[model samples]
Target chain A: MAYYGTNGYGDDAMDTESSGPKVTVREVESGRCDFVLQNCPLALANSLRRVMLAEIPTIAIDLVEVESNSSVLPDEFLAHRLGLIPLNSMNVASGLQYTRECGNCDDHCEQCSVTLRLHVKCSSPENLLVFAKDLIMVDGRTDDIGKPVIRDSAGNGPLLAKLRNGQELKLSCIAKKGIAKEHAKWAPSAAIGFEYDPNNKLRHVDYWYEVDAKDEWPVNQKNAEWESEETAADFTFNPDAQPSAFFFDLEATGVLEPDEIVHQGVDVLQKKLAEIINGLTRSDEGMNGGMSPDGYEPAPAEDDYAYGRGGTTPYGATAYGQNGYGGY
Target chain B: MSNSAERDTEMANGEAEEDSADEQELLLGGLEKLVILPGQTSHAASFQIEQEDHTLGNSLRYFINKNPDVEFCGYTIPHPSETKMHIRIQTWEDTPTTAFDALRKGLEDMIEACDVVTEKFTDARDGFEASKQ
Candidate 1:
């Protein structure tokens, strides 16, 4: 949750010595974010990406009830399409749980789910483009409830299905919170990845000024130099830069904001790690005399007096090793 | 065994054992080999695994890609419909053992998280059912 200064590189920059993560948001809008992570390892960055992409839960159409369908697409095919449509998942942070996980006994309840009904009967001779806007949220929310869930970045209502004259489709879809591990529809982000950050520094301003307008610079000729001294020289090819830092870019599926996705990703990762630690700790404790339910149990050692060759001699006799089968 | 540990943890976490769940045999078998990659300061490994689908492959890639020591990590399914997944991992600035340790740790963490979710839901369900009485 901490924000680092915009200075990407400096001798006395944010303390890399400290374990605290240095997060600098380069750009953040509704569903897109570019951020720089200093003092973060590749693993942590990758974990954040993984969590944001798949682990972070989002609402999606899980179940569809079709009342009627006479379109070219079968009822199952139409339901499948509806299920793939992403829904706004910001409600997850607002104390909403998955329908199955919720306290509600009803399969379809408002507290854990949202319902969208689509009924399109094309009467015109021309083909009708049934946009996402056509699927009205029937749970008493505004008409625009499903509008933000569209995968199109432009927020335009995506065409759900095409209907010919006299063709109709009637269905109710239930949106529930689930992870992308279960299905791609629940993935919060369309893409999440990071690259190593090269911490570059400008050593000599004069060197850059001399190289300006000359094709000597390694980078693109157009981006070689600033027009004036006031403008900063391009450090596109700095050989010296910190290798540990990473630049991360995440594009959301409009289910959650990009910054929120990162926060949620980190939160979910921490909880997951904590759970693992707890399980390991419990297992370690169970090693001490705890009855392992359905686990391995060593067989008790057999007494030798009853079955050994020494039994033929005497109860207290020690068997000699003279015979091949004899033993102590 | 790790399987015993997983089962115990799942039971403690109130995970309902679904009879039809896909076996993690492919992942476990691949991990058992611990194939070491050549020409890396830190131990690196590349291996292929055949499973029923790409779910485990994608999950493993996502899990392993998060290690700081993992210099390069990528996976290819080879074909769109093929179940065989090839994963290549290169690690530097840390021991190859660290990468393996992280993989084991990541899988355990995922299992544990599922347990927690199952427990939470079970508790909520029990309370709801009790209230109905």
Candidate 2:
């Protein structure tokens, strides 16, 4: 309701030292939720979105050792598909260690990693659809931790591969801790839908239209509460208006619950800051003293700074420069 | 030759035979830095965080600037390849807090804010499930 071009949050949102967050959750279904964050700075909102998408570490299959395969899918292709399967890693961040950081063993030890094995052979006359449920943990050691998330009530999950009759496949893989930035398989969220200035009141996007502006773009349908009553398609432009509200519609992968991802993401963000704070307490050691580190030179600057669109054709150039259509 | 740094890369400097090593090195210490600006007290300093970009920088700026005692707070990623952010903080003259304390508070605020979102999202989720049944 606050997205109706209200300037009430102009001073308060910026001035308040610890202004409490105002959240309105519209809908919450399994693996998905629609919510609005109000009275929060756009930068802070973006941080949350970006952190949840890439920073929060999640468990996923990193290395796969194939034993045998007679199935139609190649070993590399099958391993890639296995990496995409969402594992149940709820509340396990505290226990897992990133394999790279856990230097106790060269590659992986019990403390740093977990193992899952799959060995199946088809004897039936028809082809068999192999699923993630078939991949069982060695010794069932992680039974308390959990298994691959079932895609449906029938216990069917992501299809890893298909095997014709008399075909056999065997594989043993290791799951390791990682962040989405390193590889997307570790990402916990299916999608983080970030929307700000839903009415385009900030004019962040320049609309391209051939005729009447209203005909090409309708008043935003999201603010139906006011748009329905007030059919006018325009409002006064406020050049100094800062974003004080935001809307995020997100969907969670089965690896973690919606709330857990937000919590872990915040933890990771704080940990990163705390590292810098810790660096403040440490002695400088005279800054690269006694030891020598290599040096770097500035990037080779071509005339790229003044390199405007000199090659633009006459017709295309008319839409930009001093006509209020600023070229980036 | 006087200001070689400002000149473009392709420009030819014939007179100056100065080796590249003699010129000042950019980022000599490989992103690990917490140097205080000359003539400034401990109350105002800069911190360099490694392996991070704007996701933390812009938001942390907003949080630290929220402090009434803070005089100024800002951050920048010196280079894209460096994967680090340099944050500068300056607190007010008479404030009890220091630059380091301001950064610590800003980071703590983000954690608490996350708790708020986690709680609200959980409640909304459970409430919706209850109403559905």
Candidate 3:
């Protein structure tokens, strides 16, 4: 069977039947992780990176209303700030549809959007800080909407504004599901990138030869300690130890885990490839069915055979027969 | 098209007839959401995007880094796991909106290129089948 490349797995680490592509976590935290991916092309790695950055869906504040604002910020400015607040999206993956596509409402409804209200009035003389904690889900709708109310997991909501004494502010906001491709708020990964991993290189020199300087090769020079034979160094640089392997750094937004971002990216990539394959297959089936270029109907089978054999004239000359007495 | 026009009219009329109802306990806001705010060379826009952590903030920063006109671009999530993403952008000689326009354009170009690739693949497959027949 033909493979995608001549050296199907590039430059060193050969793949056995059991070892195709290996992914081992190098480091992981609540928001970020790094992993080593072996035996995969750089192209696939980059595609996954792009998919993680642009394709994942998350919920965000889509609309806002400022009923009254005596604060220093303008209404639009305050609304703009309110819209930038991050909401927990644990429920997004469970089939929460985009508000535009929701069938139940014209613009938005409880099923498509969750409303948040922020109302604050400063009575003291000192400036007051308005934080995310102050914003509450309206109408006890969090339960009614079936979407969890976005909470300030950090306990203290991050500060939004500072209001002087006697300044009052009131606003209402709505959150909805969306992807980062439409807006940056929904991007799943905080940071994602990859670099090629150096592979081991083996060298067979005269038994007494000393290994070259560290600057000469990019791989770690510590592997030179493995030279066993005294006369012939038989040094192995370990440059090809992990061929076609890459070190990937991935950081997830609070909405998803780092591993889930990678998994979802691969899932999206597979789905896209499947769609292309399906489309190509459909085109092939249509053509094989003898569909005309502009239509789906197949060419008449008998007519095709008769035309190929020259058994019928192009304009029906056989109807006139040998004599010229045929009716017009 | 007609449906869109009707919706537009309804939206316009809805905005015209509205004043915030005080007794409703701050629950009455319209459907029109704030997407991007206008500015001179530097602009700040907030979207209702739930960027739980640095994912979107970093991705957008990466994207902004690719634009020559962008002077600086950054995002902050004021509340964790809350649905708000604030993006601030500064551009070199161009309006802040241009930076966002470029980002949108880049996305559109990628989509168009992908569509073209799919179309070409379909055409090639059909041609191969037709020749075999």
Candidate 4:
């Protein structure tokens, strides 16, 4: 059969049976989890990481209308801070429309948004620390989002700002559903650490060292454990070995669970493939009808940054050099 | 008498093909989903999936290789800068299966695998939530 380098993938862990891939959850908590995804390559593993980081949708404060502000923070500063607070978005996908698709109303309406009002006037003489919990879900429309995600269940959540006595900070903020690619606030996971070949069995890199490289270098316990019996007896590099097991150290914010992030990550890839299949199966003429040709248009910037929010948007930086052979 | 015209058309087609292959546009409705390489039998063939890297190619190969009918299935991204993924599939010669059939079946299998993961994760998620209370 001369398979893809019959001995290339020196991975005994590769499962050839029809049983499919395996996911063994290790230490799983409400906000974090450790797991190993087996019987897959780096491509699938990386796709999961990318999806969890930028594609998984979550609810965040997209827009904030400050009715009055006597607090220390400026309006946009306050708005940006409010936007960062993680909102409980368990029902976002089913409950609200992406502000862009909600053509029902140009302004805030039942179809598109959930209104969160923050009205606080410090009557106490001492300083006041305003937390995300203070942003009351006044409108019943917010039933979809539920409430803020407080990571420390026993303690008060993220601190928004501090105010002195007689100072007032009043705002009617709009929280909307979005993905991290558009605005970081919507990112479900704060971080995702993924590794396919932690021991570097693939020999992807050559370690540079001076004098007696092997004798000088110390072999870690984990790396030594991975060494086969023959290799442990005598060092022999497998030039064509392939990576099999993938370890994921996924840490999610209060907004989404570790399992949900992984599921949605795979879902992003599935939907992508389904779309490709649909495009291919369709006749050439009608192929354009269903497929969105205009690739990823980051959901319209919810914040106009009329607050003079100068974003460093690099324009026309990508230049493609001609690579066509003079004669074919 | 029409030799020049035929040559010009051939060159044009070649350039058009090169143009499409150069640009990887999986979701952009630009490139064709699959480009079957030339001069291979139905049982063994190389398919170039456009605008895709190892993410789809390697995962798809894993699924297709699981099929007992498949003798061999592997994929390679031609170059780092280029987004095209060339997947080579070989089925048992006697089996009535074609490489194209294996790819389609692999895609369905991948979807099934995704459903399984979602199901398992859902159970875990519910447990996590239940413990939160």
Candidate 5:
């Protein structure tokens, strides 16, 4: 009779067996410290600060068309009162003296004058009143209802009353006109149009991997991975499971250095030594020679040692056949 | 033939009326916030405010004046202390995020654009400081 016998410790049973060398899995949360150098232009920084501290003004004005008999102000007259002028009619004050020689005899060169050219085309003429005002009402205001609008009312225009939109109009009456100082300055011409979410985390994780053993070993061959895997399986296969031997390295976070781990490693020191030797060699060669074979030279000998005799002679004693100049 | 011609004429009249109505609406909308700054003949004037303080009113004035699209009108307001003035900007919109960002950036650029002016002003101020010293 043929009997079917099953091996109690079969290959399949062994494969499913959990028995193995227990691993002390440790989870290490570490970080690497890196430096970011940001250099802000001094001029830009000062400008930003200045702007932040300065009072910014807002100006606004409006123009409305009124009926001919509406007793409304005329655009030409208003332009004249507000110091707005046509491009062709701009004239610099003659009495003003320029330290820099004025090339334009008319006292109205581009350098000293401003040109305002406005052309409005309307299909139909109605009661049109130009209303203007600077929104930023600081200290300046119109003192009177009727101010003389300074503008060129020469072309296709009828006699009309005009006034500037704002009362406190600041004109360039200083040393120079048409210069940048006469004009208002604005910062950044364009805006960054992108949206930003502050809560977003950085995509890259900053970490420093280190081997616990002092001796150099293959990283892939380390038992830590297997031990960690086994420990993780035992702990319900949770990927976030911390191993018993693994730990966090908090010193590597931001500006802090991993002094404990770094000091323990000799690679950096060795690299620094190599760099110093290279630097010294470069400096020495550069100072003495242009990398020429004859660049190096021996130090000079001492003059007294080279000239003096090795044997000692009696004080004031003369040589043989010579009179003893120092004899008692 | 007369009936067809009458129908065409009516359609034309309706189209004209519609166009006129649209134009009137546009004119009224534009006029509501209109501002006119009359300046002297042969001279150009511009008004501006800081980006932070810019409003629809100021933006309307800028639009009416036809100021340079790229270059902001130059204007500044005296600080509350009255010791110094800051540059202002006028824009067409009033969203704080956009306005502040523009203003901050514009201020930075203005410093560069007006470098010579800034330097001169600084030197003049420095001279005054030295005299006091």
Candidate 6:
């Protein structure tokens, strides 16, 4: 009867948001309903489940990124392709393209550039190669398309991406399924990034130089010091030439902390549960009692009218028998 | 017998006769058959009485509408050719027993109101007939 859709990307910076690529879909009907979600974070999916269970009839969910950066395969199709796994699996750390370079500015030149690093540590040698190969392939594709690439001079490889010890591959694809047809379809409709300044101070400058001196230097001293001015001059001061404390202020905007984001998702789910319970309770109350008119008194209970031997008659028993129950 | 005694006796007899007439009129005008059909449930209830009146339809509607919980799904009124009045009520699945009971009470009230109207109309008609005579 009612339909609702929330686009997670309404916030302009989708790329930088803690939760990436999210979509929600809800459908309701007279007797039953279905929900399809996709590309949403796990915490979000769980929260949506609670909201839906309150009133929806049937729900089917597909969590795409349970193993982060994994391919976005349709759940039904995947289930048929691969047998169901009873045990939970950990996310595999994959390579992310950090930088790339080529000589021609076009991707064809060997002299142009070479570098590739991964964000995650490979579990094994084979995994390292596999991850490296994947990153190279991705870089090649991006270079061919003329996209800007981050180049790593340290790693002489043609393509450079990073892989932290626990950093896993975060693939760009649908992370969930269920009511996700519009936004979390087979692919993400768009990619967005978020950035902010936490301190709110406008000072982002790196260097400051100041020169101070007395208005009139001793006249004789000045002339004498002219030749030795370099050694005796108090006019100029260079505060340590070392670079100002290397500082970077990158604040989170629309970027939820991992835990906070998870909690937000769960809250949506809880509200849905309450709605379902309330709907059921209301239906039961209307069935039994007929409408009672305003100011009407309830009739006496049947038990109250019953006398000693049997239930009270319309008139006295003696009068009823003698007159054969004549008219009132 | 003394005059006052005689007068009292006469008044008592007259009162008895008037009571009998009123009873006869009420019996003739009362509901002939009442049927209440609840929504979705297959079974319908039927009550037999002595006469038919338009009050049955109005009362049924009033009863269902009065209850906040009773969500009327639909209703059907019999064709003019049908002899007895039939009323159908459909209530929301969530309605409580108290609300349903209230609806039943509303129906009874409607019926009583109808009886009073019918009795007044009958009385006026009788007066006109007597005057013509």
Best by TM-score: 2
DockQ of each: 0.04, 0.14, 0.01, 0.09, 0.01, 0.01
lDDT at A286 for candidate 3?
Answer: 47
The model with the greater DockQ, 1 or 3, is 1
In CAPRI terms, where does candidate 1 land?
incorrect
Q: Which model scores highest in lDDT?
A: 2
Better DockQ candidate (2, 5): 2
Residue clash pairs of candidate 4: none
List lDDT for all candidates, in order: 0.51, 0.64, 0.48, 0.62, 0.23, 0.26
DockQ of candidate 5 (2 decimals): 0.01
DockQ of 6: 0.01
Q: Which 10 consecutive residues of model 6 chain A have the lowest summed lDDT?
A: A85-94
lDDT of 5 by residue, A137-218 (tens): 2223222111122233442222323323331222221112221111222111111111111111111122333753213322
lDDT by residue for model 1 (A39-64), tens = 54344556556667777777788778
The predicted structure with the larger DockQ, 4 or 5, is 4
Provide the TM-score for each candidate, comma-separated.
0.52, 0.74, 0.50, 0.65, 0.17, 0.17
Candidate 2 — number of clashing residue pairs? 0
Stretches off by above 4 angstroms in model 5 are A1-37, A41-44, A48-106, A117-328, B1-133
Q: Give one digit per residue, the lDDT tens place, for model 4 in A100-198.
A: 334355444655577888888888999998998788887786364747777676556899889999889999888876667556788889898776543
Q: Quick one: best DockQ, which candidate?
A: 2
True contacts kept of each: 0.00, 0.23, 0.00, 0.12, 0.00, 0.00
Error of 6 at B111 (Å): 6.3
Better of 1 and 6 by TM-score: 1
State which docking tier applies to candidate 2: incorrect
Consecutive 10-residue window with the lowest summed lDDT within model 5 chain B: B27-36
Every model's Cα RMSD, please?
18.3, 14.0, 24.5, 12.4, 39.8, 37.6
Write the residue-wise lDDT of candidate 3 on A1-328 in tens digits.
4111112223432233234445556456567876655444344445557777877666777677778899988887776666566666654644465554343566666766778888999999999999877887875643323233243566655577889999998888888766665567667777776555222223222223247533344542221222211211223344333325556678776667566666556555444433223322333344322123323222233211221122221222121111110000
Candidate 4 C-alpha lDDT tens digits along B61-90: 877887889999999987876656788899
